[model samples]
Target chain A: MQVYVDGIGILGPGFAGWPASRAVLAGEAPWPGGETEEPSAAILPPNERRRSSALVRWAMHVAEEAIRHADHDPRALATVFASSGGETGVLDQICRSLASPERVLSPTLFHHSVHNAAAGYWGIATGAQHSSTSLSCYDSSFGSGLLEAAAYAEVEQAPVLLVAYDLPPPPSLFPARPLTAGFAVALVLCDRPSRRNLARLKFHLEDVLRDAPDTLADPGIEALRGGNPAARALPLLTAIARRRSSGVRLDYFEEQCLSIEVSPCPP
Target chain B: MVAMTGKIMAPLWISHYTVVTALGRGLDSTFAALRARRSGLRPCDFEDAGLNTYIGRVEGLEDLPITGAELMPFDCRNNRLALLGLRQDGFEEAARAAARRYGAGRIAVILGTSTSGINETEHAYRDRDQDSGVLPAAFLTRYRYTHNTFSLAHFVRSYLGLRGPAAVISTACSSSAKVFASAARFLASGLCDAAIVGGVDSLCLTTLYGFSALDLSSAGPCCPWDEARDGLSLGEAAGFALLERIARTTDSGAVALYGYGESCDGYHMSHPHPEGLGAILAMRGALARAGIKPEAIDYINLHGTATPTNDRVEDLAVNSVFGTATPCSSTKGWTGHTLGAAGITEAVIALLCLTHGFLPETLNTTRPDPALAIRVLIENQERPLGRVLSNIFGFGGNNCSLIFGGL
Candidate 1:
């Protein structure tokens, strides 16, 4: 499948948006690593904004950035939100509540705990009635999400927004699944070529029985890519940032990967 | 901006399908229960959920743990339900047959679940050492397979020996219904030649307590569309359908997915739009995608969860789309609201109605709400059915509508 990347959004440690992360991705600036700042989803109503979890904020923050970069109405685009561990904080809270003698749960927290919370909040924030889906594939979440988005864009002939985000598991569950930090990335993919196209991606599944997925050249970026599932998009993002044709492989499962041939569109 | 996608979608053959719910295993038992108007619901007797509400719990899953050395890692209520569902109606055999016909590498496994194996995680947490605050070592290795949302697809793919793309949609109740749309798109995009689309959600304390917290659980068997309706009866179910892009539909029982539509409520996280705007859009979108008039539909499987608000709102949506002409009913009264699995469960029921010339009435509903304009059938309609529409709405305002027709 092939689709044109029209816009990009990214947020992680020491980076908040596409332009802010471009230098680091292009190998022109030092990797200044630090804790990620809390994203404020002011676009949501005040009540929802207050009720929003960190994961929801991270996903919406990047989704909003991508929509702005693409200069498109958010209401018109279908959306796909992907994550491995969804709403860790909420999960921890629910587990803790269940463990208690009373086993009483907060209604708001219970409702917010669904995997589509981010997509739901996005719809409310933007009044987007377009189709939206939330999905997961563990470490392969990014590749799976990208594949779904690209396929939707091509088959439906519509622009689609794909958001992949994951936050570190709560401390109680960290030992079982240790994630380094929170990371989120969004892409607006279109079936047709446009002046806004950053690159054209041709994707197909490849069987690499023994080979590992592609890794970033920069050590800091590589660590980020390895630490979080959503950060696995670093290599593809870097290739787009460099504006050079390249082949990038993303982990899809144990023995197979998603191979993408990236051809940069002329500026 | 995105373009409106209303063009007619190519129909995909439903080669085989199977379901495991409180009703029973596979098609024959489920059909028997539906015909006899026997609900699978009973008082909550699940593993110490201790809730007052009734539940549609599958029986005997405790002794039926996934025991294979390779599959033991995925031994959980959700996967057990999936195994039970897959082993029925020759679903697994049909999957293998499709793999043989299209190559295992060209068949995708896409499933939907709201809580995939989180029951095991809850147990693991309960076993946590107090002072050390560490989970049991034995449960750590199985965490990925049991707790992660993708475990459903992973286990299904591995069990079926398929090497194709796999994913798990987790958009609450609408998850499985949306899988049909995703599979259709993937097949159209040439990513996969065949697809396994289904969902499984097991009964757990999280949902029991969570819905109790939200005051959405009914103390009795749910009576959708009833004037005295209270709330939903929670249930657990697993269902699967083998889909292939083919025109071979000579069998009388064969049904094809004609169209699917998905949308967001953009209203509230838990509460649906008072006007059912998203529901209307989804229904209209499905009709547009099928390139059929609303009057063409013979039956409507309402997403009537038995909650007063949900039933009334869904009634308004149905009235807006198909009006009172089309007879509609909520099978949730039989299976309870199966959450993520509701989509495929109800979808399979809709297919059964298409194949068998009968429309199931709302099982426990005696009197339809007088305020609602849509026709809520209280008696089963025995007649030839051609096309049917199923609706599934989930938390976070996710809504999906799927249309199925006999070929």
Candidate 2:
């Protein structure tokens, strides 16, 4: 199946926004080093702003950037939010509270720990009553969510926003699945081509053993992709930024991968 | 809400489905219990962390052994229930047959769960080392496949030895119901020929206490749509369904998935839209995709958590869409609120209604809310039905409605 990517949003260590990251992906600018500043999600109301967690802010940050870049009304597009381990910080807090003698938990923390917490915030932020789905597949979350969003856009013939984000678990659970830093990537996919299209992606499901994802030339970017599942889109993002057609294979499961051939479209 | 008015897609077949809830292990017991209107809920008796609420805890999970050597690492309550669910009614055999018919690489596994292996983590937290303050080595070793949300899919894929695209949707309560929509997309995209979709959520302290913290747990058996309804009774369940393209299936009595619609409330994180605006949109979307009218629906499996707000909002939505004529009931009273697994558990019930030809009564709901305009069935009515709609809504305003009918 073929889908058009009209816009992209990315956030990770050393990369604050899509424009800066696009420059880095294009090798036109030095890779920003060190921790990136997290967004406050000031767009949300004061009540929600106080409740918005790091993961929710990261999700909304990219989603807003992508929708803004695509110039698509957020309300008109369906959404798919994918994360490997959702809000492990909140999970750890709750687990600690549960194990503690108090056995009491903050209601806000309890609700935020849900897998769809970020998606909920997104709906409130944009008032997008369109279909929204939150899913996860461990390390293969990005590939699974992309396929879901792409297929939905194709079937419904409407624009769909695909947001994939993941933050490292707290120190307690970090050893189980460690990550270098937080990562998020968003793609505004449409069934039909538009003037704002960045590139056209043609996807096919291949029945083959999972292959290691392509590494970025920059060690900083490569480390991010290697550690976080959502950053797995870096290779494709690089290709799109370079305005070059490339084939990228994303891990799906044990013996299956989603192969996508990207063709850059003229601005 | 406007009707979908879009091109109707070909229907998908529900070739096989099974459920393991507080009721029983397989369809026979589950159906029998539902027919008897028996409540699976009992006073809370899970692990410590005291809370006075009824719970529908599945029996014998601790004793349920993971038989496969390869699946040992993924062994946990959730996966055990998933394995037990797969073993029931020869679901594994049917899945194997599907893999053979459509190559193992062509069948997808899409399951839903709110917290896959958090129970293992919770237990691990309790067993942390005294001085080190680190989780036990055994826990770390088991964490890879056991604690991950995708572990359910991973375990199922490995157990069946299938290599198809697999994913786990985790939108809290509506997780499993949305998997049907995901499976349909895979089929439509030609990504997979047959898909194994369902949900498995085991009881854990996190959910129990979390719901208690939210004050959404009911002290008594949940009575959805009841005038005295208070809150939901938490439950643990594992439900699976095999979906195949209608053109490829020749199985008799296979229930057809006519349409599915998903939407977000854009209203609130925990609370549903007061008037169920999202619910109406989803129901309308499903009917539009199915190319059917609201009056055509025979019954609705309401997402009645029995919470005052939930039942009231859902009633408003159903009344606005299907009006007061169509019968609707909340099976949650029978199985308790299964969270992520509620979607498939209830979907299975809707399908069973097609086979058994009886509209299940809203168990435990003695006095229906008089203010509600929709028909809330209190008695199991014998009625031959053709089409049914199952609604599953979750936190984050995630709402999904599925239409199932006789082929």
Candidate 3:
């Protein structure tokens, strides 16, 4: 499927926003490895911000940034939020409570445990009534979500926002799925090019047996990409940052990977 | 309110479908239960859950572990239920045949679930060492296979030997229902020719205790639209449907997906919009997409979760869109609310209603709340049905409505 990217939002350990991340991804800046910055979640009402989890905050932050960058009406466009392990920290807490003697779970935590919590919060904060879907594909969640978003844009001939995020699980559950850092990336994609278009992407699924996915050349970014599933978008993001045409393959399924042709559309 | 363009979409043929609920293992048993007006709900006796609420638990899962070395890693109540559902009514053979006809890479597997195999993790957490808080070594397999949301699609795709595009939609109760819309778009975009769309959600402690924490668990069989309706009776179910592009001049008796609409309440997380504004949008959007008026719909399968607030809001929504004239009923009384699987389970029920000419009434709901306005059927209606709409609203205010009609 083909779609034009209008805006980008990214956050990671060393990166903060699209502008800074673009420099790092383009090899023009040093990778300042550190803790991920806490999100303000300014777009959310105060009460919701207080009640929101880290994952929701991270997702909402990027979504807000991308929508602002694209200058699109948040209430008008559809959204797709993808995460490999959604609210793993909250799940861990719930499981621990269930394992305890009292087994008393808080209502807030219980409501926030659903996989679509971020999408829900995004809806509540932005009042976006358009169709929103939350999905997961283990390590390939980003690729899966991108394809879905692109498909929706192409079929509906409308703009769609794709947000992919993942955070490491709590210590007890971390060993099973060892994610190192929190990462999120959001892209506003439309079927047709606009003045805000940053790149055009043509992505399709391919048999993994034919070739392996592309890898990052920088060691630090490569390590980050290997550590977190959402960071798998680094290669494509790099292509966009360089303002050049390139192709990158992303891990999608056990037998299939996504091959994407990225052509920058700089204004 | 979002603008409605009312552009009709091409329908997709539901070539094959099957479901496994507490009603029984196959469509025959399910249809029989509906015909006999019998419910599958029983007293909550699942494992060590001490909650004093009714449940619609699928029996025999304890002895139905997923077999074979390739699938042994996915041995959990959820996947076992999925396998059970796939084995019913020749769905596996039909899916495999479609895979061959379209090529394995040309068919996609899209399924839905709220908590996929969290039951395994709950057990693992219970078995963890107290000192180090370390889970058992065996949990690695469970986490990678059973606990993962994508595990459902992975298991189904691998079991059927299909290597096409696959993903697990986890939008809570609206999960499975949205799979239809996604599958249709994927097919339209030339990503796949045919698709396997379904959902599987098994009973787990998280949902049980979680709902209980919110005081949304009914102590008796769920009674939708009842004046005294209190809370919902949770159930586990798995349902699958094979969707192929409709061919020219299809059989008149065939059931096809005519339209699907998805929207978010953007109001609350657990509670629905007070006036069911989101529900109304979804229903209207669906009707617009199907290119049919409200009167064209003969039967309405309500998402009456039996929760007082939910039923009341849905009542308002239905009345506003289709008015009080359309015959509407909630099937939760028969199979309890299956959460993520509710969409597909109710969808399969709607397809059955289209094929069997049976419009099931709202079971266990005797006294309809007079405050509500929609026509709530408390007794079975046996009439030839053409088009049916099924509603599924979930946490995050996620709402989806699907239209199934005889082509």
Candidate 4:
């Protein structure tokens, strides 16, 4: 089944939102190389804002952006939040507490340490009682999430929101799975083409294995893609930004790749 | 069965299923334990968190060997339980046969886990070097395969030697239950011919103490629906099922996944909606997807965590949907609340009821909560069952209900 992308939200180091990142992806502007601070999620209530972690903030930021961009009711869409490792900052704190003599874990931190904490916060903030799923698949998290969201949209025949995000682990975990930067990408997908659709994505899971990575015109953007699994969406995002019909291959598993043939819908 | 308003999903056959939990390994022991109404929860003795609570910990995991040499990097309590579960009831052999029949590339692995090998990280932090503030080299080497949330699915895919699309859903306690929905989607989307769906969550200091910190851990074995129920008893478990399209299955009496529903409470992070609004949506959605009415359900494996809030809210939800006629019980009293693994654990139990024509009681509950309107079974009863609904709710208001029935 073909899935249409109605909206896109991109956040990463030096790239803030879809409007600014579109220029960078299209090579219309130079790649801005700098550290980007975490979003505060000012849209959330004060109580929720105080409890929100960087992961929640990033996830909510992109979710709101995508829903708003689509001009869709947040409550109407099902959601899939994908992350490689969830709330590593909270993980580190809990680990440290458990390792200490006191073993006094913070109640708030413990509650928020769950893998679906971001999805929970999003539901509360938006009063969206629709179905929400949080998932991960190592380096293939983005691809896995995309497939899940697309498949759900197809089966439910409804617009589904897909959010893929990953934040770097603490310094202690750096040597093992080194993630240089945090990134998040969101796509609002529908089963059928609609007026809000930015592009039509024909997604297919091919049995053929492909190890070659898509090259970016700028080495820096490629670095960003390599640095984080979520940033792997950069190639497809770039294709959409350019409004060009192109095929983007995403690494899915050891022996298969998710091949998407993108055809931009005319406004 | 009464007709429903939503689309009826094609049934997926449950070819093989297994469970490894405190009730003992494999289906036989778990079923026997359930028949005897035995409680696997013991006083909390896991790694000295010093909390007054009960835990349902799988025995002998410390001695269970990791599946293979390449799997050493994934060695941890969670993965060990996963491997243990895979080896039980000849599940590994069955999975291998399916892989051969369908071709490895057409089989997908979707597992649920909340804390995948986080215990190893906790140990690493405790043993960190005082001088350089660095963790042990061994910990770092296995961090990617051990601690990452996706490691469970990655390990399972590698161990089983199947290469279809894989994912790790981690929506807390409802994690594994949602995998059935995802697998159905994958099969419906023609992404895979068959899917291995399950969940594995192991006992860790993080969960034990974390639940304790939240004051949600029970001092004694949990008693779901009991008038005096206080809190939940944390437990660890691993459960798996091989799902295939019913059209391709030749078995005459294969149990099939009839329907599933998922929803978020959007009410509270740690607490449930007092009215069980999300639970109602999930249960109703499941029936709608199955094209059946609430009265058609013979049994319900409730997401009864034994906490006052959880049990009370679930009672309301069940009462709201199925009324007081559906025989309902919470098996958590036998295995404790397995969290992420609870979904599959209960799913396997629901399947067992269909196979054995028995109804499992809510173990350890002395009396059903009189305030609740739903019927809460307190003893095992023999009855022929055709359709069963299993409920799994999680933190962050994630709720999922699944319908399983004989073809």
Candidate 5:
């Protein structure tokens, strides 16, 4: 059975998501259910004054977008947050302290630095009872996460939420050609079957594409804006979220090994 | 593309163990802590810190820098954990031998980390406001995001001297667990004769404040399965497992990866489905893959983070499958949730259990959740067991389960 990406939210370099991603998906109709626009960059809720890392802020926005897009109540869904680099902003702070013998890794960045932090934030924000998972597949992050999530949905016969986001690394440390700054993504997956859904995912051991520009895509809005792998869920989710209620289908793929087929229903 | 597909060619082997956590620097100290049931839980102690929270801290990486420091440059705390973890469980030997056989090119080193080297990179940034075309003469490159994690692979590759398919699996909590599956797939597919797969995550401020902001960090030691379990006590650890072709082992240890299953629930952004559906799929997948019946398993090593949601859902998942009768335990109590390191650390423990034929206790369960259908081993038990199961459930609804059986 192929899993359909029921709902999605992709936050990129700019934009709160729904509208931006919808345009990219080339949707046939306006977002079926209409969209809610929020302050794009705020980390915590509008009422909450907590300062958050760039990653957390981006994650929060995407998470909210994904929850709403899925048409599922915030309290009802499960989630998975994947990142090759989790909250790079916070990590940079700790590294600074390491250089000084007197300064030490801050206790806050220390704990938030774990891969599970994003999920922790989402769990808390929504007061959701769903289990949250986090993953890092390096260059293959987008592909690995998609395959794993799809596999779970197939076996478990339940909806699975998968999010993959990565912030561009700050300078003065390691050097890389890609500048992956200010990007984040969020996803909601359920086991419900829909006929008008996108393509379903299939897994295989394919050779690494040595020549491909990039192997994996972030599933967040940033990926959609940048046009990447995990971000593919954006257009599909955008199409579904717009619909007041209808069976729609879309497919999310990576490394060509696995594909998640999402089919969202009318609310 | 696996070379051999019939009858699942061979079982996965677990040949090494290395741990660096708040409990202690190496495997021995961790074992000691476990036996004494000494919790590594401690309040956030960094006074110069940005956030206040509890964490399981690993001491002494500052003056320690890197041994064979000449080969690796740009000291990131991440690499330090690697060096420390490798020193334990006689892991260095396995790493050294791989280097010799694979010419440092054929042997690949895979790492699982939630946050790779962001700490070091951040340190350099605080020293400078801009990247001036020229790097500090003494400073090392490769600390960049594109390179740091990958470089760490090479750093370890050069450290242990392994020469094949060196890469990092940054799949958050599932990072390390995925390493095992990748290594197994590679070996069975004839990609490599031997591979080192594990996770290394160090405590950093970002995680602390980040988790704190989420309101998930426990003010006290994490209580897995305990009714009062509030949240997790963050810890840093580097764990490695030397996986070889199943047929290559001559040792007395019967620890081998019998089966593995992984899945993602696209349910929401952060929470796991209340039913533990993804988790159940993973566990079921592993059992099927290993060709072992659920009842045949003697012990289960859970990915219990002691979080309010994870505990309850995991309990339901266990009950749905194994029924509360099976012996199971969450070791997070002894070793704070090591995040990326949790998978491999738990893998090593799973291997150890199969060898010792004993089920360890869940450290801080004051009272097992009444809803739990499986026997949550509150106290360590000695018993002969042929098969053991290890479960790692991560943030993306990313769940992976591996069942290990005797040789």
Candidate 6:
């Protein structure tokens, strides 16, 4: 189905919020290229240069920018916030509270503990009256949310805000990092448009086997990390925000095989 | 007539339900206890969990083993319910046989869960720190590995040696119910030969207090559809079924997903529209998709959380859609609210009605809701039903309705 991305946002290490969205535009982030867990400079809130868990930091920064970019008047568009690792740190904290006397769960932490908290908070802040969702999948978290958003757009014919991000594996809980650092990407999908026009986006679902011999090829990469990783939305958002058409295909094959196609519109 | 392309042949036999609830373990246990119609309400003695309300706790998850560090985490409440569900009615063996016959890699494992393994993460994190600024080394890695999504996909795949696409749908309470639509899409698109779609969500701190925060929890066992219907009784469960294309052989037959309607209410986050407009839209959509008349529905297993607003709104929608004569009831009184798993659990219950020809009673209701305007099955009765509908509406205005049929 064809849907227009009216807005976009980004947040994470190396940069913060919309400013951090530059990584996607440049198509590169300079790093030591090793296991030395250094977060990229494209993420938001420049203060956190050396810290880990950039995913959480980035997700928060990017979401706010998304609302602003869409000029999102929370009174309208729906939302879908996705994360593969949902509040890993919070889960760690709650488990800690369980074994103690006078189990006092933090009200602030608890409020954000639910999977939909990010979406909920976004809604609450923006005064958006539309429904919101929090989703987790086997890496396809973004794809699933996008498909659902696409369905929402096709069926309900309304604009939707989609966010995908992952915090650094809580070092206190689990550890899988280095290139796996945190980042977030957002887009506003609607049937209508408002802008210094960008390309119209169409999505198609394709299934590619994990063991497919050519999975390492371009087509496979398009089917694997191209369509909807939330983070991968960065490439599309950056390209569009910079007023460049240059097509890009994303592939996220783990949960489901899906691809997003972008073709520029004539001004 | 050229039927909907994805629509498979009708099934002659109905499926059976084997529920695992705090009301004692198996279906025989549930059914036997159900015969007497007793409520299994007991105090929740969570490991220092402060909430004092009662829960429909399923025993045995505590002793269940985790594959890695107590920190690395293994089968948690989510997986426990899955194992419990697989144990009932040779579900595992039956699923195994179906996989073997169809070829092992084709039976997709599609599950719906909330707070998948946070119970483990919650426990691990607390032990590592008290006033610490940084968490312990062990918990950070393990909690991230298990809870949200990956562990669930891996856990199910490893346990059954399942080789198909492993997916975990976490949409809060709507998770399981929505799986029906997803499975149908996959089957229709020929993505998989068959699928075993269901939901498994257990009681956890996130849900328990989340509901409490909204003041949606009733201190006593919930009274769904009753005038005194207070709130939801938190519970845990797992329910799944074998889904395949229509084959000529009249074995278990095909219980294909005939139709599903999904819509966002665009209403409130925590509450359903008082008019049930979204609920009506969903029901109507499913009916239209299935090409069936509203009056064709023999019974409806209502989402029926027993909250004042939900029961009232759902009642209005039921009356408007099927009129006041459609037989319906809320099984939540018997099973408590299983959240994400409720959709599949109730779907299994509805399927059993078609197989057994018996409409299960809405166990305890001294007085029906004065606000309710539909015909509710207060007592058990056996009736011929060609089709049935299961309704599920979750937080955030997510609305879904599923239709199943008997040949």
State each model's CA lDDT, in order: 0.89, 0.88, 0.90, 0.89, 0.62, 0.63
Candidates, ranked, lDDT: 3, 1, 4, 2, 6, 5
For candidate 2, what is the total of clashing residue pairs?
0
> Candidates' interface RMSDs, in order?
2.0, 1.8, 1.9, 2.6, 8.5, 6.2
Query: Which lDDT tens digits does candidate 6 get at residues A34-114?
Result: 221332433333433232233444554566666677675645676667777666666655555554565555545554455
Angstrom error of the Cα, residue B90, model 1: value is 0.6
Per-residue lDDT of model 1, residues B138-172, tens digit only:
87778788888999998998888888888999999
| Per-residue accuracy of model 2 over A1-267 as CA lDDT, tens digit each | 889998888888867777888888889999877886877666577788777888988888888889989999888888999999888889888878877788888998888998889889988988888788888888889988888898898988889999999998888898888888899989999999879899998876554335555657788778787889898888888888888888877766544556788899973
Model-by-model DockQ, in order? 0.68, 0.69, 0.69, 0.68, 0.10, 0.20
Model 3's CAPRI class is medium
On residues B306-378, what C-alpha lDDT tens digit does candidate 6 reach at each position? 8888889999998998999989988888778888788887887776676667677776666897768898878
Worst 10 residues of 4 chain A by lDDT: A204-213
In model 6, what is the error at residue B213, expressed in angstroms?
4.4
Give the TM-score between model 5's chain B and the true chain B.
0.90
Predicted candidate 4 versus true structure: per-residue lDDT over B178-223, tens digit per residue: 9999999999988899999999999999889888888888899999
The estimated TM-scores of all candidates read 0.98, 0.97, 0.98, 0.98, 0.65, 0.76
**Best-fitting candidate, measured by lDDT?**
3
TM-score of chain B of each: 0.98, 0.98, 0.99, 0.97, 0.90, 0.89
lDDT of 5 by residue, B49-131 (tens): 54455677778876567645565574568788788788886789877866676554445466777667656554444455444
**Global lDDT of model 1:** 0.89
Worst 10 residues of 2 chain A by lDDT: A205-214
**In candidate 4, which residue pairs get closer than 3 Å at backbone N, Cα or C atoms, i.e. clash?**
none
Task: Tell me model 6's lDDT, rounded to 2 decimals.
Answer: 0.63
Off by more than 4 A, model 3? A204-210, B248-252
